[model samples]
Target chain A: MKANLTIISILAILFSSCYKDKGNYDYAALNKLEIKDKNGVINISIIFGDTLRLSPEITQTTAQNEENLTFEWMVFDNSPASSYALPKTVIATTRNLAVQITEPPFVLSQNYRLTYKVTDKRTGVSSFLFYNLTIINKYAQGWIFLEDKGGAGDFSMLLPNGTVEYNVYSSLNSAAPMSKPVKLEITPFQITDDMSPSSKKIYLLTETDGMEVSYQTMQKKFNYGFLFYAAPQIIKPTRHTWVSTSTSATLSGSLGVVVNDGKVHTNLVGGFPGSKKWGASLLSPAGNLNYITAPFVAGGTTYTAAVYDVLNKRFYSVGNTVLSAFPSTASTVFDMNNVGMDLLYLDSANVVREYNAVFKDETNTPYLLKFKTVSTTGAPNLTLLKTQMNAPDIVNMTAAASSTLTPHIYYGVGNKLYRYETTSNTTFPQFTFPAGETVTKLKFSRQPLGTSQLAAVTWTGTESKVYFFDVSNVGDFTTYTNVYSGFARIVDLGYKVP
Target chain B: MRSYIYYFLLLTAILAACGKDNRVMYKEDPRIYFSKFATNPDSTDYSFGVKPVGLLTDTAYLTFRIMGTAVDKDREIKVTIADSSKAKAGYHYNLGPLVMPANAYEVRVPVYLYRKPGLKDSIVTIDFTIEESKDFKPGYNDKPGLNVYDRLHYKISLNDQLLKPASWDSRLALSFGVYSKTKFNFMIVTTGKTDWNSTIFPGDQNFLIQTVKLSLYNYEQANGPMLDENGVRVVFP
Candidate 1:
C-alpha cells in the first residue's frame, strides 16, 4: 500500500509540472544586417588628391526597407600608437561614400581606419563594418624641377613611372606664386618639432627670397625670413646644403647650412625636433668675418664641411661654428691655404673623403684640385691630386656634376656635355643638345643606389628640356633613358628620395 | 566534505582581499620654503649685473613652493632680509607683499632692484629667508643631514657696469666686429636691447646689426666720427 501511494504521488507531481502555464510572451525575428565591400575587399588604397569612392553591399534579413536605415562613414588616422589621440573625420552620412582625399601624404603609406555604420531606426540597433584604407603620396618619389615660368617660379615633377606633372606648385598654391627660382633642396629627415610622419621638407629658393614647402603637397610652410632667428637685411639666398653627424652610435643629427649674401649660416636639423633657427654667421679661425663663394660644400665625417673663402682665397674646413684652415705643410701638390686660383666648382668626388674642386688661375688655366679633407685618423690630409685639366672648354662650363662612383667630372658648355677624367687628365664629349640650347642645370641623382643616373637640363630661347642618361661604370653616358620637353628654364633639379 | 568547506572559505578570503582600499594617506605638515631658482639645485646663487645702458630698474622673482596639500584660501608668507644683506631696503630694493594664492603650489615673489649711482662702482647683495607666518611655517633647513639650503635661503646681487657679453666672442664678433664699450653702447642705443645673449635669434641679431650700422653711419655724418671711450673711431665689420 505504501509503494502504491509513492508511485501515485510521483505521477501526480509529473502531471502537474507538464500542464502549460500560459504567459504574455511574444515571438519576433530580429533584423540581421550584413555589410561588405562590393568587391569583397576590406583594404583599399588611393593616392592623395584622388577621389575615394566606395560602394558596399548591405543585406538585411527583416522586411524593413533600406530607407528605414541610416548610414554613417568615418575615417581615422591609423598610425602607430602615440601618447596623443589620433584624429577622426566623418566623411559622409549616406550609404555610398565618394569623397576627395585632401590629407597630407606621409613619408610612408599612411593607414587610415574607415568605418561604416548602419542603424535600424525602428530597433535602434547599430551595425559597424571596418576597412583598412591606405593613402599614397602622388609626388612621393620623383625628380623635382624648379623652373621659371616667364618671371614667376613653378615646379614640375617626373614620376618614377614616366608620368609628368607640370605646374605642380601653381596648381596647388595659386595665390602665392613663387618668385624667380634659384635652387631646390630636399631634407629627408625631421626638421621641425611637429613630429609629422612626412617630416621631409622642400626648400624652394628664389633670387630674392626662399621658402620651405611640403615635400608631399608642395604647400608653403614659412618664408625665408622665418628660416633664420634673425634674417639678414639683404636677402640674397644663394644655396643650401645639409651636413649629417652621428654624435653617438645610435643618435644622429643634421645641420642645415645656408649661404646668404656670401655669408654662411647654420641651423640644427634632426635629433631633438624643435624650432631651430639659423644663428649668426660662422667666423674664421682668426675670429673674423669671412665670405664663402662656393654654393656647395664637400661634407665628410664629423660635420667636416670644406668651403672656399673668396675673401681669403683659401680652403677652410668648417666644423660646427668656425672655419679652420688646413695645415700649412708644404706639399708638391698645392697649397690649400693659398689656392690663389678662383674656384669654379666644388663637390665631393667618387672616392671616400676625397673632394674634387675646379679652379682657374690668372691665365684662365683650369685645374682640378682633389684632396681629402680629413684622414682616417681625423687629421688634415689635404693633398690628394692637384693637376691642370686637359679640357680647355671647362673655363666656360655653366653647369657641373660629379659622382661618387667615378673619377670623372661632367660639365656642360653651351649645348655640349664633356667628361674630364681625373686620373688621366683626359676629356671626352658625352652628349649634345639641340641647336641654340644651353645647359642650365646638371645634377647626378644623390639616391644611394641610383647614383649612376644623371639629369641634365637645357634651355633654348623660349623652352627647356630635361634629359636622363644612364651612366656607365667608367663614367661614360651609356644610354639616353628619358627626355622631357615643353618646360620653362629649369634652374635646379632634385630627387625627392623615398 | 570538511576539505571542501575549507577550500570554499579560502576562496572567499582571497576574493575579500581584492576589495577596494579605503584607507587614507598620511599628510605632511603645511610648510613653505624658497624654491631653487634654476633647474639645477646646485646653482644656488641668483645674481645679474645691470648693464650700463640706461636701464634704471629691474625686477627679479623669488619662487617659493609649498610642502603640503593646497588650500582654497590665500596664505600669507613671511619673508625677512638677513642681517648680512648689504642692500638698503628702501633705496636699493623693495620687496613686494608675499602671498600664495588659493590652491597655488608655488608663488613668485617680485623684488624690485634699483640701479642706483653707487651700483656703478660696487655690487650690492640682498639675502632673503622664509620665516614662520600665520598660515604656514618655514620648510627644509640646513640641518646636519638635510640638503635644503638652496631651497630655504636665497641671495641676489645687483650691479651696473659695462661688461662684455659672453656671446660676443663666439657669434656677435663676426657681425659687429671687435668688442668695445663705445660699440656695445652704440648697439644698445640702436637696438634698445641691453640683454644680448645666445637666446637672441639670428634674424633679430642681423636686424640689430643692420640697424646699428645704419645708425653709426648717420651719427658719423651728423657729428663727424663717433669715438670710443679711448678716443678711437668705432667701426663695424
Candidate 2:
C-alpha cells in the first residue's frame, strides 16, 4: 500500500504539473491597449473661438476583441489648489471614441482632465487614459476683480461679458508654473492705469510682487524677478506706478518707485514685472518720508508728478531735469493719494472731501496757493460730498473707474456710493445703499466692447457683494446691475486698462 | 415550555420596537447649527424672527440646534459674527457663553434687543455662525441636492415692517425701504435672486427682478414699470 501511495502521488504531481503548465505564455494574447498620440505634456494652447479636435489611435492586441467597446471622455478640474480657482465640477463629457473639445472659460487658463475610458463590452475589461489639458488663456480683457483671500487671494474675471466673471484669477493662473497659494496676508491688488488694448494691458500690483496678464488670451505672464521662480523684486515698495506713456508691451513705460529706502526712484519702462527691468533712477533727496503723488498730464507731453514728504507735509515736483517743488505748490502740498489730480482727505472736522482740480471761485482757498492747470490753487478743490447719516465708517478711497455718463470717478464712502462728474466738476450721490451695507471698494472697468461702468464691492457684515452702475446716464443712478460677490472683506479693486 | 417561549418572543419584540435611533439626525455635522430640526420650537421658519416694536425688555431666543451623539460634559461652543454684520457686539447686545450641556441637543442664544421710543423705521440684524471649536465641528453636508436646501444657522431680523419681504427678488426687497435689518434679511435670504450673488446664476429665476432696482428711481417714478403688469404696481420696469 505504501508503494502504491508513492506511485499515485508521483502520478498526481505529474498530472497537476501538466495541468498548470500550458506551455510558454503568449504576450499577444493578453488584453493590451495603448494610446498612440499620448506623447509630450497634454497641454494645448487654443485661441478664443478656435475649435480643438483630437482623435487618438488606440492600439490593442490582435487576440483581444477591440471591435465592440464603450468609451467615456470627461473633463473636470482636478486641481487640489484651494488658493486658486473655484469648485470645478464636470464641465464636459463625451461617449465617442474620439475627444471633442468645447468652449473653455475664456477669462483664464483652466486646468482640465481629458479622460478616455475604454471598456471591452464582451469581457467587461476596461482601460483608462488621462491627459491634463491646460487650456492656455485667450480672452481675459475686461474687469478682473480680485478677492483678498487673506493668505491666498482669489480672483474673478469679468469678461467683456457686458459685466464680469467672478473669482476668475484662480482659474486663470492657478496652474501656471511658479504658481503657489500665499503664505501671508495679501492686500487688495492695484492697477496703475486706464488699460487700452493696443496701448495698455492690465498689470495687477501686489505687495509681494506683480503679475502681467494677456487681455486677449487671459493667460497670465511672469517675469525674471529677483528670484527667478519666487516673489518679484518689486515687493515692499510703499507705492509704485507706471511712468511711461502706456503699459502695452508695445509701449515704453517708465516706472515710479517710492520706497522707505529714504529715496524716491523711478525704474525703466513698463507697469508690470515682466516689462519692469532691474534698475532705478532717483527722484528725490534721501532721508524724507517721500510719498509719490501720481503724475498728471493735461492731455499733452511733459507730464508732472510730485513727491510729498509726509514728515514735513511738503511737495516737490519730479521733472525731466530736477526734482523741486512742483511749479505750483512749494511747501503747502498736503500729503495726498489722488483720484485724478483730485485728493481725498478728511478735513479738521472729519468731513469727507473729494478735492478735484476744479475752477473754484475766489470764495475757497483765498486764491491758488498750489496746483496744476485750471486754477491758482491746483490744490484739490474739495467739497463736502458725503454727509449721509447711515454711511459706513469710511475705510479709504479705492479705484476711480469712470461712469458711463458724463460724470466719472466713483467713491466708496462708507455705505454711500458717490460719483464725481468732471463735466460739472461736482460729486453727486450715485447710490445710497440700504443701511447696514458698506461699499468696501469701487472701481471703473472698461469692457472690451466699450462699456465704461463703475463697479463697487459692498460688505454686509455677513457677506460681500458687487454692483455695477452704467454711468452712461445720470438719471439711472438709483438702479445698478449687481455684478458679482462672495468675496472676503474686499481689500481693493481695479478695472483692466486695455 | 410553549408559553415560556411565547413570553420570551414577546419581550424581544417589545425591546426591538422600543429601541430608539438615539443618534441625533444632524442636517450637517462637526459643527453646531441654528435650526428647528431637533428643537421643540414652533415651525415658524422663525429663521426670520420678528419681535414686536415698543417692547423695551423684549428678548427673543435665537435657538441653534445640533444633532449628533450628545456629549457627556457641558461643552462651550464659540460663535463668530461675520465681519459683514454691522451689529454692535456689546452696546446693542451681548452673545456667547453659549453652552451645549452634556446629553443636550441644542443651545439657545439670548439676544436682548434695545429699542429707543418713537423710532419709526428700524431694522437690526444679528448674523453669527458657529466658529470651529474643540467642543464641536461646524458641519458636514455631503447631501446631494438642488432647489432643495437647508441651513444650520440663524439671522434675527428685528423690524416693524407692515409686510416682511417675502419676495425672492433683491431689488424688490430693497424697494421696500431703508430698514437695515429688513434689507439685510432680504439680501441674505434671497441671495440667489441677487445678480451679485456668486452662488446663483443661469437658472436663477428671480434675477430679472433686479431691473426694477436699477431703473433710475426718478425714471421709474416717471415711466412706471417698463414691463407693466396690467395693474400690479408695475413689478419692475
Candidate 3:
C-alpha cells in the first residue's frame, strides 16, 4: 500500500510540473505574405527558352511601405533529391520576376519549385510564397520541314495544332546557318558519352555538310566530320539512316548508315551512354574496282542495311565493318548481283523483312521490285514479287515514300499523288494539287507509337505547303487531316516525337 | 528519492555513451606501389618498329601511387631492375630520376629505351621492382584469386621489328585492309604516328586511313607500286 501511494505521489508531482505557464511577454505577429498570378493561381506552366514573367499580387499584412521590404525569387529542380546535391538558382531579386528559362527540357514536362521570399528589413522577419512551375519543350512533337532557298536553307516546324514556326533552325542557330539541305532525320532516343541517360537527336544533312542538333533546343551538337571514326575524303553527304531493335524492355540496340560521296559507311548507332563512330567505306572486297552506291538505303533490325551499287548495278549488304554480296541462289526471284537497272528509290516496305525498290531501265521503264532483305534463316531472300509497273505515269514520278503498316508505295508525278500496291501490282490515284503546283517531297511518319500519316510537300509557284493525310488499314488516304503553308521549297520533312 | 537517483544514473550512462570515436584504422607506415591505369592494368609494351627508321631512342612512363596521405615535402623513389631481366640497364635502357612532388599522390617514372642493333632481331624485356625508400615501402603484392598482379612490380618489352598492332584485325583491318610489316612501316611514315593502339576513335581511324590512302596514292604515283616483305602489292582496303 505504501509503495503504490509513493508512486502515485511522484506521478502527481510530474503532472503538476507539466502544467501550462502563462507569463507576461510582449509578442508580435509575423508578416503574412500572399502571392498569386492575375488568374489567382500560384502554379504556372511555360515553354523552354521562353521568358517567364510573373508580376504576382503580393500582399503583406504588416508591411505597408514597399521600400522597407526586399524580394527574392528562386527556382529549384523538383526531381527527387539524389546522392549529389540539387542546384538552386536565384532568378531575380526584384518584386516582379522576369527571367529567361534556359534550363534543359526533359522528355516529359519537368516540375520546378519556385519560391518568392519577401523580407522585412526593419524587424528581420521574412515571408515566403511557393509556386509549382512546369516547363515544356517547344520542339516536343512536330513535323520538321527543311526549306531550301537556293544554296542556303532553313528549317520550319509545323505543329500538330495547324500552326507553323518558320525558320526555326535559323532562329535557334543564328551563327551556324544551314545550306543546301539534303535530308532531315530524327533519332527518337540517342545516348552519347557526354549525355547521361538518353536524349532525342535531330540530324540536319546538307549537300556539303551534316550536323547533329538537340531535339529540345535545335542547337548544333556536332558536324558531319564528328560522325565518322574517320571522315571520308569527300564531304558530300547524301543520306543518314538509323534503325534499331529493342534489346531489352528498357534498352535498344541501333545501327546507323551514312551514305557520303556515293559510298556507304556504317556504325553501331549509339552506345549505352557512349559515343559510336562510323567505320570505313563499305565496299566489295572481291574487286579492286571503285564503287559508287545510291543515296537511299534499306535498313533492318539484323544489324545490316542494303545499298544498291550504282556502278555495278547490284545490291550490297553493309554490316558493322564489311560490305558483302548477297549469296547467289538459282531459286532467288531476281539476281541481286545483276539487277542491271539504276535504283531510283529503295525503302523498307510495311511488311517485316520486306523491302520495296523502284528501278528504271535504260528504256525508261519503271520496275517495282519487292524482296526480303533477309530471310527467316538470316540469309538474303529475293524470292518475293517483282513486276514491271503498268501505270503510264510511274516513269514520270519524281518523289517516292513507302508505308510502314501496309505494302504501299506513294509516288508523286507533277502535282498528282498515286499509291502503288506491291502485292497486286496496282496503282491508285490518291490526290491532285492546283495548277502550277508541283510535288517536291513525300514522306510517311515513322514514329513507332504515332499514327500512320502520309506527309507530302508541294511547291505552288510562289510558296511551298505540306499536306498530311490519314492512312487507312487498306492503304488508302481516308481523310485530309491538316495542311501547313508558307515555306520556302521544302526539300525534306521528318516527324519529331518525344 | 531512491527511484529518482536511479533514473538520473540511467540518463547519465546514456549521455556518456554518446561520445565520438577516434579509433585509427590505417597503418602508420606509408607505402607505395606501381599504379594501374583504369584502361589497362597489365604490363606495357613498346616497339621502335612503329617509329621512323631514323629514330633511335624513346621514353615511356611507369606510374606509381602512394597508399598514405599526401605530404607537403617532395620524396625520392627507389627503383631497381630485376636480376633476371634480359635488357641491360646502361646499354639498352636508362632510368630517369624518380621524384614524387610534394602534395602528390602519384608520380611517373620515365624509362628511356634505346634501339640497339640486337633489338632488331630479338625482343628484350626489363622487369622493374619498387624498393624501399625513406618515405615509402613496397606495397601490395599479387592477389591471384582476384586476378590482380603484384603492384610492386612492372614489366616492359622492347622490340625494333615492326609488330602488328593489337587492334589490326578487329578495328583497323576494315579501314586499312590487310596488315603487313612493310605496310605498317609505310603507315608510320605517312601518318607520322608511332603510338598506334586499339583505343583509336572511329573518326581518328578514318582520318588516319584517309591520310594514308592519299599518301599511298602519291607514293605509288612516284615509285611504281609499293610491295610488302612477302612481295604482295600493298593496298588499302
Candidate 4:
C-alpha cells in the first residue's frame, strides 16, 4: 500500500507539468511537382522547397539555422490526404520534400492544378503557392495478316470469332489474296481422314458470285456445271509416272507417316490434273535410267528419299546424282551403287540424313538437305530426318541426338519432320515426292491387333483427299494419351464438351 | 514516529480521493433489445423494428441490459429468444437506444447470435407451453411473403435428330409419304428452381430428360400432322 502511494505521487507531479506552455510555433511545408506517363498513363511528382523564414521571431543565426529547421508536409482539398511516402522523400529537416501523384484519367486537353504551402515553425507564419499542369494525348496506331501465301499447298486463316478464309496460291506472286477463299462457316471442322497424305498445289479462284472455284479436271468427260463440293482434303504423292501425252500422274497413299525398325517410311498420295499416286521405286543392277548423277549444286535440287540396297553396303538417293539405271515397272531395286548413291547405309552411324523436299523458304531463299547428329544407342542405330523444304520447322521425331551434342536443326524445311532408327542408323528405302511437292500430312497408325504402319497425307488441290503408305515413318504418331491425325482441310477449329 | 505515521496517513487519503474521482466518472452500463422480439426464419433485416402503422400502439420489446461497476471489463450479454422450436435461419434487426450517463461509456459494440435450420421451412415448431406473465402481451403486425427461393432457371438444348416424329418433324412436310422423322436427345436442365418435393439440396438441382414420338397421322391431326388431310383420307382408302 505504501509503494502505491509513491507511484501515485510521481504520476500526479508528471500530469501537472504536461500542461505547461512552451511557446507557440508551427512548422509545415509542401513542395516540388513532377509528371510522367507510362503507356499513355500519367503520374505526378512533387518535392518540398528549402525551408524559409516566414517571420521575424525565427533565429537568424547562420550556423544554428540549418540544424534548427524542421517541416511537416500535407495535401489538402476535397481529396483525402495520405501518409504514403513518395520516392526521394524524407522527414523534412530543411532541404526535404517530394511527393508523387499516381496515374489517373485526365481530360485530353484540360489543365490541372496542385497547391503547396509552407510555414516557419520558429516564427509561426505560413505562405502558399499553386502549380498548374496540362495533359496531352499521343497517337500510336496498323493492320496485320496472320497467314502468308508463298508456301506449297493450301491453308485457311481463322478470325477471333471462328470465321475462316481459305488461302490458295494461283502463282508465286499476287497483289491481293484471292477473294474467293473457301468459306468454312460451320462449327470447327474436324479431320475425317484417318491418316497423312501427300502435298500438292491447287489454284483457287472466286467466281463472279463469290463461290469458291477449283478446276474439276479429274472427270473422264470434261464438261461445265459438274457440281462437286470442294471438301478439305489431304493428298500424298507416292511416285511420279508419265500418263498420256504431256500428263504426269501420282498414286495416292495413306495420309500419315510411320516408323519401322528405326527406318522412316511415309504414305504418299499420287495426283493427276495433279492427283496423288502411291508407288515405290528402288534402282536395279543396271545403271541406265535407274541411276542419275550430277554435281551437287546449292539450289535446284528436289526429291529426297531413302532406298536400301540389299545387294550393296550403301543407300541410294535421287540427290546430286543422275539416273544410272531405269526400271520399267514398280520393282524393288536392291543395288545402291548402280543407282549412283555415293554413301550407303552406315549401320553404326545414328545420324539424321535429310533430303531437300521443297526448293525455297518463305522469303524464297534456297535451302539444302543436310543432316545433323541425333540420339544413338545399341548396335545399328538409325536416324531419318525431314526438314520443311524451305524452312527449319521440324517435328514428329524419334531418338534425338546425344544430349551432350546439339544438332544444327532447321524449321519449315522438307516435311518439318523426321524419323530416326536405333537399329539400322539409316533412312528407309523409298521413292521420292515430285518437285514442288511437300508432305503436309504425316500420320502413323496401328490396328488394334495388327502391325503399326505409317500413313502420309498431302494437300494437292483447293480440296483433294489423298492417302499413301509411309515407307518412311515420319509424322502421324499416336501415344496412349494423344492421337495426331491430319485433316482433309486445314482444321478451322476444335472443341469437346467435358 | 507517531507524527510521521499521521503524515503518511494524510497523504494516502488524498491519493485515494483522486482515484475515486477517476472511477466514478467512467461507469459503464449498456443495455440492448429488439423492437420485435420473436425468432422466425422469414425475418428480414427491418422486421424487428416497430412499423410506422404501429406508432400509437404499446409495443413490447425484448430488453437486454448490461450493468457494470468500476473498471470496464469485456463482457458478452447475449439476448436469445427462448422459443427455439420456431427458430429459422434469416436476417433480424436488433434495436438499440444504447444510452448511458456521461461517465458510463461502452468500449465494444453489442452483437446478436442465433442458429439457422439447414432446410427451408424444415424446422417443426413445438408450442411454447411456458406461461406468459399477466402484464406481457405478444406483439402483432402485418407479414409479407417470404421469398423461399428465387425463380427457377431452365436451360433447354434441342436436337432435332433425336426429336424426330414426336418431338419434331425432320422434313417438316405434312404428307404421309413425304413425312421425315428424326430424333434428338433433348436435355432440359434447371437451376434456382423450386423443388416441389423439397428433395433437392438447398441451392442445387438435377437435370431431367423425357423422349416422345411423333407420327404423320398424329402430326396431321394436330395441324395437318405428318400426314396431310388428303393423305390422311388416302390411308382409309
Q: Pick the candidate with the highest lDDT.
A: 3
| Per-residue lDDT of A59 in model 2 | 75
lDDT of 4 at A218: 9
Q: Which run of 10 residues does model 2 chain B get worst, by summed lDDT? A: B197-206
* Model 3 clashing-pair count: 5
Taking all chains together, the TM-score of candidate 4 against the true structure is: 0.19
- DockQ, per-model, please? 0.08, 0.01, 0.17, 0.00
A130-184: candidate 2 lDDT, tens digit per residue: 7766554434344555556655655665655565466566675677532222211
For candidate 3 chain B, the 10 contiguous residues with the lowest summed lDDT are B141-150
Writing each residue's lDDT as its tens digit, candidate 1 over A1-498 gives 555565576568657988887976897887888888878889876777788888888899985569889999987778543323766778899989988887442223567888999988888888888998767677777888899887799999998899999998989788888999888977755454233443567789988999888654577878888877667778888877666554344323366677888767766544442456675566666544545656867766633567788777787776545567776652237888788989999887987667889999889999998887555444445688888899969999999997777888889999999888889999889888878999988888644555478889998888889999888777777557888998888988888855
Candidate 3 structure quality by residue, lDDT tens digits, A131-241: 877666777678888888877879998776767899888997899988899888777655442332346567788989988886656778787788775666788888776
lDDT of 3 at A483: 80
Reference-based TM-score, model 3: 0.76
Candidates ranked by DockQ: 3, 1, 2, 4
TM-score ranking, best first: 3, 1, 2, 4
Model 1 TM-score on a 0 to 1 scale: 0.72
In CAPRI terms, model 3 is classed as incorrect
TM-score per candidate, in order?
A: 0.72, 0.37, 0.76, 0.19
Best by DockQ, which number?
3
Worst lDDT run of 10 residues, candidate 3 chain A, spans A189-198
Error of 2 at A5 (Å): 99
DockQ for candidate 2, please give it: 0.01
Query: Candidate 2, which segments miss by more than 4 Å at Cα?
Result: A1-49, A52-139, A162-167, A171-202, A208-234, A244-263, A270-278, A281-300, A304-309, A319-322, A328-409, A420-427, A446-451, A473-476, B1-237
